[model samples]
Target: MPVFSGIWVALVTPFNEGAIDFPALRRLARHLLDAGVSGLVACGTTGEAAALSKDEQLAVLDALLDEVPGDQLVMGVAGNNLTEVLAFQREVQRRPIAGVLVPAPYYIRPSQDGLLAWFGAIADASTVPVILYDIPYRTGVRLELDTLRQLARHPRVVAIKDCGGNPETTLALIADGELDVLTGEDGQIFNTLCMGGRGAIAASAHIHPQEFVRMADCIANGELAAARVIFQKLQPLIRLAFAEPNPAPVKSLLAMQGLIVDELRLPMQRSSPTLLQRLRAELA
Candidate 1:
């Protein structure tokens, strides 16, 4: 329920010399929780879910489960393979998670009908609530408004991590009020919340999660001016989080805190020296 309506950190999967670091991962989860993040999303794009093998992904989820309650965790499920994705979903259900964060099949562009069919199957099989991940930039396909509205009709499809970047669609979704609209884009968190969004699944919140939590709480309590101040302060870190690419920037800051090792899986690189300097200055 927290992930459905509050600031859930899109966690970075800690790695050590190219291997999954379970102990460090658990430590990071506890760190975020202690900072008051509403919940944690394991294996999201920020967590490099794509780079990890299925077994490793589940292992990461299990490790987090050891540190957080089921209601405070959401498992990210992604893959272009329908059968494999469904099977992974089944495996994920063996544990008690709040919901599954699923995006459209990546790389293979599917028509709206295809998108509908794809989500339909997943939603049908889902025992837990489904949070539709609509990040077209990464998934290479968009979940048009109509497709989302149709999916909203499903009892299981209860929310969306909205990073589609179409404001009109965002507004429509907010107005429709069927599903909880959680912005995945860090920069849009404030605007989206003001537009009646449920909350955010923010990657930048990984740095100062308590502030993000306070910001959301402020907005919810009708303290717009206070919320704006928090958002403004977080704006720099949010911009820098994506300045290079994803968890690299976020991971760099966390590493500086000695939370985890400064590492990332191949095909992804660690933050550059210059960016690290900027990160240090920003945190300073």
Candidate 2:
């Protein structure tokens, strides 16, 4: 495994006037790196991967790679089409990424066997390690524990971004210990870490990233009281971040900080006025 531990920010793609804001993206990547996140995940759900064209995604990756080391970057890859996904994987593998974060094929809702085959084939083709993304809610199918356990046998399948929302599954995966369990659910970071999980791929960390990092360190060092206090302070921000559809409230807060313009692609809008008020209050 490539030590996919600690807080890895699921970076939002900053847009400006309907275009990918490369400078802002670079600045944000540098900011997160300066704040001490373990790594950055570009083109993930938080980054609005679905909204970006292949060229735009690669450009974003390029900008981030320029700012952050390749080992400190994980690129998100998802699609219902296996061939296209594999081809995209081949294209991205040319860069020295830490690994590719892959979700099960969306929309089609493949059987466990199909899921195994899908991830296995991608894992086989990928030169870098694979971080299995078990976000069933977005992908429309769960990567069940048994299926995940089966995938663990693959030499290239090294970690999991767990958003399955099942504590039993989370506990099982941690107990199994075959994969490094990094919770994708921001709110679960504290609990997941306490439960013997490795780290987080948090969207909420974008706001006060150092606190998220410190919280994880506290838990890792067995300082539960300190970790609990940090989590309590961060709870409100996490709630507000996801209050709107992801990255909206996140981008809103980031824009307020002047990190990026608060823009998101259409179909995905900016944070609502009500939530913006809350975010402002929270940031204040």
User: Total clashing residue pairs per candidate?
Assistant: 0, 0
* Candidate with best TM-score: 2
lDDT of 1 by residue, 88-160 (tens): 9999999999999999999999999999999999999999999999999988899999999999999999999
- Which consecutive 10 residues in model 1 have the weakest lDDT in total? 1-10
| lDDT tens digits, residue span 1-284, model 2 | 43689999999999999999999999999999899999999999999999999888888888888899999999999898999999889889999899999999888988999999999999999899899999888889999999999999998899999999999999999999999999999989999999999999999999999999999999989999999999999999999999989989999999999999999998998898898899999989
Which lDDT values do the candidates have, in the order given? Answer: 0.93, 0.93
- The whole-model C-alpha lDDT of candidate 2 against the native structure comes to 0.93
Give the root-mean-square deviation of each candidate in angstroms.
1.1, 0.8
Give candidate 1 misplaced runs (Cα > 4 Å). Answer: 1-3
